[model samples]
Target: MTRAFLRPDDARDLVAEQFGADRRLTALDRLAGGSKKGVYRLRLDDETTAILYVWATGENYWPPSPTVPDDPFTDASGAELFATNHAALAAAGVRIPRLLMLDRDNRHLDADVALVEDVGAVTLERLMEHDPAAAATPLSMLGDALRRMHTTLSPKYGKLAAITRGEAPQTRRTEDVIVDRALGHLDAAATRDARLANAHDRIAGHVRLLRSTVTARETYGLVHGELGPDHILVTPAGEPVVIDFEGLAYFDVEWEHAWLRMRFGDAYPVLRPVDLDPHRLELYRYAQVLSLIEGPLRIADTDFPGRQWMLDLAEWNITKALAVV
Candidate 1:
């Protein structure tokens, strides 16, 4: 029950034990691009490499209000949830890193950690920035992979718990969850800037309309809540593999589509086509903007850099979302 963060020696010891007494951990390098978790690239004496992901505690993770008493929307710790999600997605034939071992009980490490096979690939975000046209084939492949993943259906929609438990986590309707999150984020944004109050009211007025759009959907599917380019990696063989399952949930497919469209625009080719409702997508896009703002606003008091840039981007997106709504 150590309260201290896991150090390099701790990780090396765990990796050595998992591999063998003879096989030593040669190097442990912390990887970037994770906000809520710590990822390390580990190299062994045998020349094999792997990734170690340490899940964030509730205190460090975002979307939990520190000021509000009895905040019901806090995200549960992702340690066990990430392990469960990896198992479920791998079983469904999704292209994810091979999970070697999981430490959920915090016995081997201070926090939950997972040792996974490193694909030794570059992230799609870097590739896209270097050459968008050259990255087309891989992007299309990712679209196909996502289409396959969407086939994973669930009985109810909400958080990752619903997907793991195979039932709704609570009695509240999915529409209520969506609306409440939107309102919560909007309120948070308004607290930082009074100008956002009007935006909040405008979006609030359209809650019923937005709810109707979500309710009209006949089925719920597994959603990679944050499927941006950074989470996707392209292998040397030109295959795309997905990573980061902490945000996985059961929700309307349009929310996933909207995320891609907002991030990649028309350049991202949606291979497996669906009848997209533009109005609904726009509403969700607004919700997405609000969600993006929520995290930065919630942590504004801290010394986190790039907070202003995020708020600026959120404001810009809000303007775009408002134009359509």
Candidate 2:
């Protein structure tokens, strides 16, 4: 279930200006899903639709309520990213809100908001939860979605080649940044960038392991960055829809497939007998887990612990890589 910050009435008031007095929000209910964007069931007349409220902030919610910025509450600023992504994905055969109205520039809003069609479908996660044996169905569907998205390149998406087959920006390691900031509190022996001093070397070795396994013939064009049960939604009829494009970047398109492989484990055959380099994939996912731990580390006001956790995951990825590579 997704946590919503806006009360139905408040959301209605904020959006009432868009739909017009005639199209009153006959009903508004919070739909369960999305940790990033605010989703709801909106009704007016005979139409039962979904509306996504985009907040400008990267917090992935429309600013329905106020929480401290550092506290991970709604940020009205990040809406631009969604607007860009939504439009891009929509052009690529993905279904998003109908976009009746949007603060596309959203430069002034505390949270960016957009009215879109709420596709009625159960998330892939729910389907798997209900019927674990059907996991492969969703993965293949996701692959199909990615195929549509990755088939062509667009500047609106920027260069994904930096990270993979396409041009995506290379982001700094969140853990590394955290470590540097928290070093003063850790051992006087530690410097800023509180990451283990040897981590870079280990990652380099792991990168080698990843590169070594690539069979030269394998080429990927883009990366979903984050793809899994939580981000994938399956409609009641077993339609898998990909959501959340904020994490998207150009990289090995196979990584999205890898993402499903990692999360679904043996239940999926998409990457069975996976051939990715063990060290590379391990390092990649280790870096990933570190990214996931950001919320916790920031909350706890700690860095070293999360870095160590990343290393543990890196180790596991190394082992998992051995099986696939």
Candidate 3:
């Protein structure tokens, strides 16, 4: 009962109010949505057309915590960012979902959702669960897809100053800024300076190292910002398609790559630097694990593996955080 639901009519009426009418539209089922948006499954009258309904988040939207409101479309800027960013990616020859419509009104709907062509693909988590032998297959494709994403398209997203970036949930953040904000909540914001409590020095060191070592150009491209089996979808034909660009932003490729390794036991792609700068990677890895240790770090619960995932990442991070080297 952690989550609630918005009915098919409620979804349609709300979406229709913001998105306008679909002549022969059919009822839709609100399924799962991540941090900034709501995702719904819509079936056309013809039964052949499948449209994914997305509604961003907004305050006063519904009930409070403990039986969370089903609404996902809550913000205005995020919807706009999602549209333009994804559109740019598509135009750049990247394979992304086709946008059917986008709203930018910060009112009731908050212009917080977009309609896109849904693919009958299975999430990487489902694929991995169904067949373990097929697990590595997704990882390889993911590497190539991610490389293309980071190398080719990321630079297109210009970096805005901290305030501007912070305004939008799906903000473009350089490593330093991201660290400060993400770890800020963990800090003693209740106090005057909002100290990061026990984690201040460690987080600062990682942030400094990340800022100094990662050159801008090599990492300048658009980062998925968040990459996990859940965010990636592998089709029935074995094709890899990525979704959820809400958090897609400008960031360091290495930071993102280190996060990716956490999922596969921190031992994938042959585990480079495991022999060299393992300490640094460990710190980097722990920073991310620590983020997940808090409930708010997650985008959604569609594929969340629970505290086990967090504990595992934390264990790996702690093992490395304590490394004598």
Top-scoring candidate (TM-score): 1
Per-model tally of clashing residue pairs: 0, 42, 13
Clashes in predicted model 2: 42
Predicted structure with the largest lDDT when compared to the true one? 1
> Over 4 Å off in model 1, which ranges?
1-6, 56-63, 66-77, 163-173, 212-215, 305-309, 321-325
- Candidate order by decreasing TM-score: 1, 3, 2
* Candidate lDDT values, in order: 0.70, 0.49, 0.50
The TM-scores, one per candidate, come to 0.86, 0.60, 0.64
TM-score, candidate 1, is: 0.86
* lDDT of each residue in 1-325, candidate 3, tens digit only: 2434444654455455534576345766655434345566766555744455445333113222221111111122256557655765575455566677665563434345566767665777776677766766766666666666666533333332221444323343344444454354234221212223444566556655655653333235555656677877776666666777655555555556667776655325632322223444454455565455333322222334243554454445434433421
C-alpha RMSD of each candidate structure in angstroms: 3.6, 8.7, 7.8
Better of 1 and 3 by lDDT: 1
